[model samples]
Target: MFFRFLFAVPVIALFCLPASAGQYDAQFRQFLKSDVAPAARQAGVSQATLDRELKGLTPDTSLPGLVGPGGKGKPPKINFQAEFKSPARYFRDSQFNALVPRGRSLMKQHASALSRIEAKYGVPRRIILAIWARESGYGSAKIPYDAIRVLATQAFMGQRPEFFKGELIAGLKILQNGDVSRTGMKSSWGGAMGQPQFLPSSFLKYAVDFDGDGKRNIWSSDVDTMASIAHYLSAHGWVKGRDWGYEVFLPENVSCTREGPDNRQAISAFVREGVRRVSGKPFPANEVNQPGNILLPAGRYGPAFIATENFYVIKDYNESDAYALFVGHLADRYGSNKGFAGKWKPMKETTRGAVRNLQQRLEGLGHDVGGADGLIGFKTRRSIGRDQEKNGFFATCWVG
Candidate 1:
């Protein structure tokens, strides 16, 4: 599910005139008429729908990450001055403990429907529940914004206005289809709507009405929401009978630089090289012959994993490795209610700027740190490891 914090362009700045708060209403209305209406109309939305939905609509300038009227403000920074937390904090056992009981209960409550959903979609119920808890606290999280207003506001003044422009049109199309009322179509400030937190585009493509209620009502229907999330994962190529990953013990002799999807090999190969499940159980027979890759989210300073192709499939839901790992770990806790056996070792606190400097240094030596983005992605982590090996030190694959 994409978080749609939407944004806008410059020549159109002339329409803003004085660009004051009061005038923003006038400007937004103009934008709807001039920019949005035609695109929405071309996409089969009626003139009546346009006039009715857009009448008196105004921009929400208070939304975070806006870049001013014409997307002219500097992009938001990563708060480089703040200390980056370790995985121990991110993957707090109390946090998972609190979530697991509810997840287990929901699993039983929805067991029948979930079974059918799993049968149809080939996605496990546990994974679906984990994603549900993560996305919107299993529909308990409030999603209170008018989706049209949020999308329209984003299209008018937020960053990535063109992207939001498309989303705004899609939002209008959702309204025109009568799948949801304009008033009932609540979204986050960023425009990810309903329980599954689907963007309008995602709703159109993947949402399913499993409850037979004639609406893919992610807002209030637990069954529909669960099925919709399952449908999303299935569509994204979630492999049946495969686990996302396994917590593992990586031998000290193995380099952490071997992390990432591109470095995948048979799980059997990893076991042959001395990787073993922290549980001491063998890799599942179904998984042993299939491909897997090293995954050290905090490099070697945290728990080690041998992630499957299914792990990357989960990542397709949300790009962050931490997010995918969290979902996988949470799903596991449904059965065992245990945390990772391997510990997340402590490291010195460092700023994003400091990390970026390290990344830049690695890039200077012709290593690809994935554009020196300051965030330590797999490329950065592995680059650090490779650099360490080059300098005759043990490769930790992390920012020291």
Candidate 2:
């Protein structure tokens, strides 16, 4: 039986701290005792569990914004052009293709266990394999940080406290259940653990024991790991037969601003606006009724995708649109297509600090570039391009 809980906290009274340098080990301990301990107790976590998992565990001050002295002076900037243009850097087609045979072999290795899981739950095998390959490189990758320390840091010092606080408690429960040792509860910076990179809260809800060991162990057990991934997607409304989405050609006159998910005009509406599917194929009956949004991931230069409801489902797993595109494209590479056909434009690769400085400078000049968030989303890029045009820079009107 899978136990799922959705603990939604309103985004009110949450304090945002600037990235500061200092060791908060004492403060962190105080936070655990005063704030986290009571909350964990209310959520039914035993005192024994808290001591076993969190006692003597120091906070990881090396997290993104919490780096100590001798580290780089400013937060790292995102180099958009370099990231996108060099396929080897980010999108390695050949290396990704090589994983297909390995993925198939692993799928076959766990076939019996996966078969039992599929019988009980209607989730498909390929989708499970796709998620497995995309996250942690089919279980070959190692999760790097201590889960509790990472969660606590994010909760106390990082941006989203309420969300991370719930996850922090969920992680303690995983330790209490004896599924993982406190020492072995390693995970990503954001506290996503094990083979499928599940956030601790997500693991408690969606993890399953396919090996029948009476414990849902996702760290080392392939059977349990893959089944847990399958269960997660199935719970989150994954339709088996439908493609995640498709690469399509928009008409020359179709405004690129209408491409974001927010402006998801109905397919029929887009069709009326001279937008045609790139494949020259008729829309599937179920999909035509479903609204599709345009995504210009790299502004006007790169490939455009008409994302379906499933795309949002993928985003639920990882919020970044670029990450979703990478996963979807990686899956496509393994299954069918070689690569996207769109021509990419070159843009300056600015570091996170540089982008923030640029945004501040542009805003000072009344360009209305969104707040100095390091992420170079479409709005930021457009604002940058407009400023560049005014400043007499070689304006291709692209944002990095």
For 1-400, candidate 1 gives per-residue lDDT tens digits of 6432111000111122224577577767788888899999998889999989999888877666666666666655434443456667668899899999999999999999999999999999999999999889888888889999989988887778998888888888888888889889999988999998999998888888899978888888999999999888898898899999999999987789999889999999999999999998998889999999999888888899999888888888877788888899999999999999999888766766778788888889999989766677888889999998999999988877
Q: What is the lDDT of residue 271 in candidate 2?
A: 68
Error of 2 at 247 (Å): 0.9
TM-score of 1: 0.94
- For each candidate, give its TM-score against the true structure: 0.94, 0.73
How big is the RMSD of model 2?
A: 7.5
Q: Global lDDT of each model?
A: 0.84, 0.68
For candidate 2, the per-residue lDDT at 317 reads 75
Per-residue lDDT for 226-328 in model 2, tens only?
A: 7898788778887655666777776656655455556676676766776666667766776776688877666565677788767767767766565567667
lDDT of 2: 0.68
What's the count of clashing pairs in each model shown?
A: 4, 4
Q: Which ranges of candidate 2 are over 4 A from the true structure?
A: 1-31, 60-64, 67-88, 111-124, 152-165, 265-286, 348-374, 378-397
RMSD of each: 4.5, 7.5
